[model samples]
Target: MKRNKFWLLGTLILTVTFILSACGNQNSSNSSNKQVLTVATSAEMATLSTTKYSDTTSLEALQNTFEGLYRFNSQNKPVLAGASKVSISSNKKVYTFTLRKNARWSNGDPVTAKDYVFAWRKMVDPTAASPNSQRFESIKNGVAIASGKMASTKLGIKALGTYKLQITLESPISYFSELMTGAPFYPQDEKIVKKYGNQYGTTAKKTVFNGPFVVTNWNGTNLKWNYVKNKKYWDKKAIKLQKVNVQVIKDASTAANLYKTNKLDYAMLTTDYIKQYQKTSGFHSKTIPLIGYMSFNTHRKTTANIHFRKAIAMAFNKESLVKNVLHTGSTLNGIVPKNFAYNTTTGDDYRKDAGNMLTYNLKEAKKQWAEARKELGKRKISIELLTSDTTDSKQIGEYLQSQLETNLPGLSVSLRSIPLKSRLAATTDYDFDIVYGTWQPDYADPVNFISDGGQYHLDDDYNNRNFRNLLNEAATKYATNPTKRWSTLIKAEKQLIKTDAFTAPVYQGGTAYLLKNKVKGLQLSPYGTVLFYRNVSIK
Candidate 1:
């Protein structure tokens, strides 16, 4: 799974517009009326294409507008959506799915099994340069196809007929069903994609929808758009709201004013407004399984030294960063957040099992810094820290700079605050000394955080053969042994954090927001699309 970065820049508000002039009957009952829900987000939608999007906001938009083989229910369990039936082979490596006959796109085209094959193949095609290509590495020939060693046509997905889909995996993934609920696994309309070519998914009119809603008024760069109900959806009757208007609001005060004036039904509160609204009836907070950490550019000589990385990690205090700077999250001891993954046998939280691998020790940090200086034969070292230009991120970056410089002698730290897109691009290009990033789980599994050859390892150029072998053993060797796989994953995490010190664990993410009492049925999950609006209704 790709690592997701969280930004606490601004507020997103959902405004409910009541249509009183439609009819007298509509005025009598709020539940029976057609309403327009106007919502605000901190950032604009990057893309609607399932194969290319990488942000949480884009995932939420895609989740509301597209249906996959399966969908997560309110309880965060996988439920059937596009596929009506499924069967697993005796070896559990092959999966056969039966597409719903009534499933139709917003353009009135029948959604067939061919759509799945085309989408999966296109995602793994090296030419596409998809950030999510690694998610399909479990499929047969997926690694080879992604690395350009083989043609995309050799991918292990096949459309048996118009409505039958067959997918062959190299190994049995325990969370394969939950993985299907992600947008990356959702099918794409090949005809629409070909017709639009390079312009596909750039705008609302350029794409087709198979879910309960279709996006509108988005011109690829605009900050406002709408999600209109898709009448052609197979289960359209279950959808309540007819239209949902979305906007990007970058100010917390503006969101507060909108909420106070009844212009907004739901608004995400920043730390500045959390205390002010905590006593209010609409205040809501959710602790998600998102962990913030700093990735070292191992390619750089200074950061490549394990002593230097350890010095930086131990110099700063995560407790102070979370309690004072962020004011919403909890301190993290490892890459995986607390209350996230549990031991399969003992049901113990992974954090409890891993113990405290990260700590604050000024003395040990000084010792590590001296060793690093001796190894590199340098009296002074300067490094740049990269972070998003969001209010919270800038604050965190500033705090880190102060803490490191104050704790370590002969150390100079510089902060580079860039927009989220630019920061992501820079991180991908390995253009910084140390970059602060976050990772949210795609599924409720430790492998999602510490997978072998996954985002965590590949992005930072941290190639510990033993670490990779441990993760590989857990996935393949102990494929059916739950206890063994659990122990192996714990070892891999230790190797990454304690042994190599490739990255520094910062804090876990927490979302604080306000929702009107009238809004109902909005489902929030810790993994995969944080927000679900399919069953949402505004009373």
Candidate 2:
């Protein structure tokens, strides 16, 4: 759906904490005055390559290690990074950026315009298979290059000088500046990439950093790593946290214990810990732009029936799912969540306009199930539910299985727990009857949510040409008309999710965490990357 690609765990790592204290590379001789902050994350990074997998963990790491032409400031607004000045044409199809003279990589190499060119070419190269390549479709010929209709050299990015970069767009996009802050748009060094080949970004040594921190102690496999402040960073003075220690803790209880023991400066809280630490000091509930939904495989005979699909969609109670199960977030109204994006015309929330398309009514569900059974001449159906192997994912899967089977009689649901990679593979390959899914926006637009990209691909057999056409029109024909564009995309979302029931929205995601009161300057932005630790410091 959206490629901000941070995976939001369905369940809290409330108790799982792997011991990485002995695994850290922080030498005993390091400066005693250096401020260090230890934080806990539920999962390990799959890769550091920006154009590769669009998962959340890798994006979190990328945000601290790389600099694009622009970045989201603490206020979640796009601010210049590598570029000192940027100019736009009247038609908004052309953009010119002048790079900062002091912009240097961790290795002290000057970040040149050619670096952006190289990265852009690599991302759109058919062989690269970058999930993010399609994001450049807004740019002139970007779609052609990604679809293999045009050579990578035919792309619209150009370098007039070592420090000057120019970009030509296919049309005027209001959120172009916000898109610049995405990980895929960040510059990459051609020399280093060629030298590393397939091994690029596989390990700390293989990667280079140009942002606030240079990653260290990562041998490519371990869950423990450190972000040491980059001395060569152009804005190093603003970086207060000298070192940020990160440990992958799968257990929520273990993370809470670590936070309680001062072993971790920050830990995301579960329902139990939320109440346990509400008055303690640094308990914060952050509303993020992540939407969790249940994706059904229409290829399955039983699921292919619209009556059966609506029965399944309405059988589960979203209120209980968010309140009793999630306990931290609100129930989702539609595919898009609340406070995620707004209507450009009215400035009101889009969720309010979409209203509640999904509702829980056991009586209505049974009626639909009976109609579906009569159509198929079947009294009962069995299917497997797929989810990640993590503690939270398994728990959510179990809860869903129990709820679905219990509420809808004669329906059987078997749970299959697999590794994150395998879960993604199974879902992408359409190997599961139903599976857990998440989508996070790459920019500040609802179009990112409605657009058919990333993990939002439904089955191919269920074609809605009108829905697809509306999306295309919104991106092109109505790109400048905020009101028409918003209305068009809203209709598309309704067609895909509510009317057709391609996806079932369940919950709006929020991260409740416990942090030391002394910690400051860490920005939990709603767009782009999840957490920014550059200016973070201890009081």
Candidate 3:
């Protein structure tokens, strides 16, 4: 009897030991399967809240974790992602989308049409204070709700069922579908959002993701963050990377050094390092639709004079600035960037159609300065220039100050390099004489930019009712007529650039980067400079 009892005890112990050994092996295998891609960005993500933030840094992070009804693919073309099917009305003022039934949040909650409704309403809520709410002004009652004239519930989006969503528009916008691919239009989980209140999206554990990856290891203000593949994503099979590690290295030299040590898979190149790596194997140079320009505060005494603005615009050498200083990007001939918009009739680029309106003529600038001085009844003028504190921005600001002071007699430019958010606030508060600003296109349409309610409109004090009227007519009367709309917008571009000189178009921005050869399938889209990493893989 004693021997039998001992044998049974030994068998049970062996079985338990075998189970524990199998579990340990499984965990080791899982750890080995985790593949991480490490990269570098210039700045930390300002905010993860979709509606409150409108910068590319935030958008890049959000797009990887929270998908919209539509998404730009690896080729930068609009493709359906969250939505399975979409139908549009004949008048083009209404749209209906059918969501993917299998899509679920990282918390295992089903993503429904009601989530979209909640997000859209929150975006335009009067109390929300969302800076990006204006992007949805084309939706029915969107402008009214944002302006506090209508209730948030009255905004033009509704859910017909668990998966069907309907939207009404005030007018037929050609780029409406493309606009839906952006981060601002992504859905938010109402219950989760409300549960967290002000703490939502402030930490990795506080937010829920439904896209390809879920943010992890973020402390809301850390220099580093991680993206872990979400197993619950409906299209998880297509996501090749198991993890992505991003480090914020604001200095270009530091980023290059990290790349050299194989610590980074990608690094952005500034003028200082472009020459050294121009012939490197992984180096690439591409121009996007980012436009860098100078905004003059028309309310200021010296800048209020139209001739003075024109003199400042023509005095600077754009070509030299592009080649000698920037070492990247092309000189801008007009406000709208090159290869940004197209002519529906001839299929030519809008910049090519408009031709070059900005000129670099010292003689003409001197003549205009003389007229400006006579008009102001002052021999000397001083203006303060506000710009971001980034290395490239500081370099450009110092160069501008030197050139403007040397080329234009009796004119002095004082440059102030502030943080990005602070610079934006200063522009909104009208606190500076001039501010160096860069704008990325929201969509393909020219009307989307260079129209009323833009930064130039707020800053430029020039009384150009004719130009404003032209823009309004194009936006409304010619909204559906592609040819006429393009023509009218072209006229507006010429007037703004040539006749009024509302803002000086400096250059079309470009990004030069060093990417590892193994990294494949990352794309930079035309709309809003959105980056798509859905197909990116390290092999």
Candidate 4:
């Protein structure tokens, strides 16, 4: 009986050992399958449609999962991505591109020339209700077609064959290639959209990717996306990192804690904490063009007063505001920020007249406030300063409230801290007297600064329409004749600055993010883009 019991025990031991060995192998396989990388930004990815919504968080996230025909390399210039070859006609009006033939979507559908043509056409289609469809107007006949003047067939793009794309434009744009490097020109698979109906791309699952990674998961607003390297990608063989993991980390303090615990690979710092991490062990900063401002409701009864407008502009000192609020030296002098590469051919200067315009002149500001007070019928100029209750916004508002009342006698300012979404809605609906805002450059050109900074009406959302109209006119003139356009845009920009004071140009900021040590060859453009995924890899 004792011998029989020993034999049974031996058998049980062997069984347990086998099970443990198998579990170990399974874990090893899963680990080998992934090369995870996470990025923690300040906000949630607002939308997956980068082309339709130009929101910063959306663009940053979509730039990774979706790709364009061309991508900017580490040198801050555009290089061919899916395109096999590129050529421009002698007149510089026509461009020809040959797409790589073997590329396929995440679902294995063959990506063809017509797929690109369909996507581009939809961008300019008026019925599409695209906010950024205005970008495609650069192509020949593109504006008229986008404006509903002609059928999209008249627009200048043609699929020469299954792998060829031809584009014609009205002007010789030196930045055309760079413009195509972003979502404004990224291709969308038409087959997936046709299959899904109105539900297409509403969630991460509904979307398809032709780029190096595809989003594998999302739960409505809470995104848990993972990227699996695309086997159908043209240069997929060169890809070293097989996977990417991104979790939504919205709070800056929480992100810092994650980094300290080694739970995060990369994270963004709050303005309050930037100084401490400026040169710390994991710190990495890159400066890109980012402009900040506070816009007023030009249509409001009190806000419509030109002197009232000018009072706000002169009330806040840009330098002190940046130093006090942002704690950075990025305070801006005028509307057109410094260091944005100037294209001189437009004859006259297009840069914002920062010198003579509103600078940090407290005495002058007090004088202007008195004049504005009289102009406003000595009504003790009081209005709501609409802004989100964000830590930065609230802090800035407190400072501004104190400064404005001290500088402008009889200026009674009421601080309103609304939710971020509410602030945005109110600004869109023209329900706010003054609100905090910023303008990000769409392209490298000066036109980006002048088109009311492209803060035009966003889909029936009420805005300073008259100011936007003036900006549009200036943009058109700049496109046709830059020199003349510069003069006109400057005049328009100044009209807001010197006249109605549509904005208090606070400070022009820049982009800065941390990168993991294991990640290699990650590059960001001066215009705020991460490009050339082909070379990015994990060590």
- Model 2 lDDT at residue 297: 75
lDDT of 1 by residue, 1-539 (tens): 23333221111211111111131124325466555566766656778899877655677789899999999876768998999999999999999999999999999999999999999999988788776777777788987897789999999899999999999987788889887887889999999999998899999999999999999999988888888989999998888777887777655667777776776677766656666677777777767677777888788899999999999989998888777766676888777778988877799998888787778878988999999999999999999998766555676788999999999999999999876656666766668898876556677788767752123325226668898788778877887888898889889999988887877887777777777767777777545225777878766
Ten-residue segment with the worst summed lDDT in candidate 3? 11-20
Candidate 3: clashing pairs of residues? none
What overall lDDT goes with each candidate model? 0.76, 0.74, 0.72, 0.60
Residue ranges of candidate 4 with Cα displaced over 4 Å? 1-34, 146-148, 261-265, 282-286, 344-356, 363-382, 386-390, 409-426, 429-431, 452-454, 458-492, 495-500, 511-516, 529-534
The sequence of per-residue lDDT tens digits that candidate 3 reaches over residues 1-539 is 00000000010000000000011111233233335566566555556677655445566779899998998776677889999999999999889999999999999999999999999999888687665666676788886787688999998999999999999988788788788987779999989999999888877888899999998888777878888889999999888767777766556777677667766566667766776778877888878777777877777888877799889888888888889877888998677888878887789988887788877888988999999999999899988988766677777788788889999989988889875545655665678887776666667877655652134433124446776676657756887777887878888877877887878877777777777765667666664344556787654
- Angstrom error of the Cα, residue 137, model 2: value is 3.0
For residues 73-130, what per-residue lDDT tens digits would candidate 4 score against the true structure? 6676778887878898997779999888777887888777787788788778877756
Cα displacement (angstroms), candidate 3, residue 497, comes to 3.7
| Total colliding residue pairs, candidate 2 | 14
| Order by lDDT, highest first | 1, 2, 3, 4
Model 2 segments more than 4 A misplaced: 1-33, 298-306, 371-378, 452-463
How close is every model to the real structure, measured as TM-score? 0.90, 0.89, 0.86, 0.80
Question: Model 1 residue 300 lDDT?
Answer: 87
Going through the candidates in order, what is the number of backbone clashes in each?
0, 14, 0, 2
Q: Candidate 4's error at 230, in angstroms? A: 3.1
Error of 1 at 310 (Å): 1.9
Order the numbered candidates by TM-score, best leading. Answer: 1, 2, 3, 4
Question: lDDT: which is higher, 1 or 3?
Answer: 1
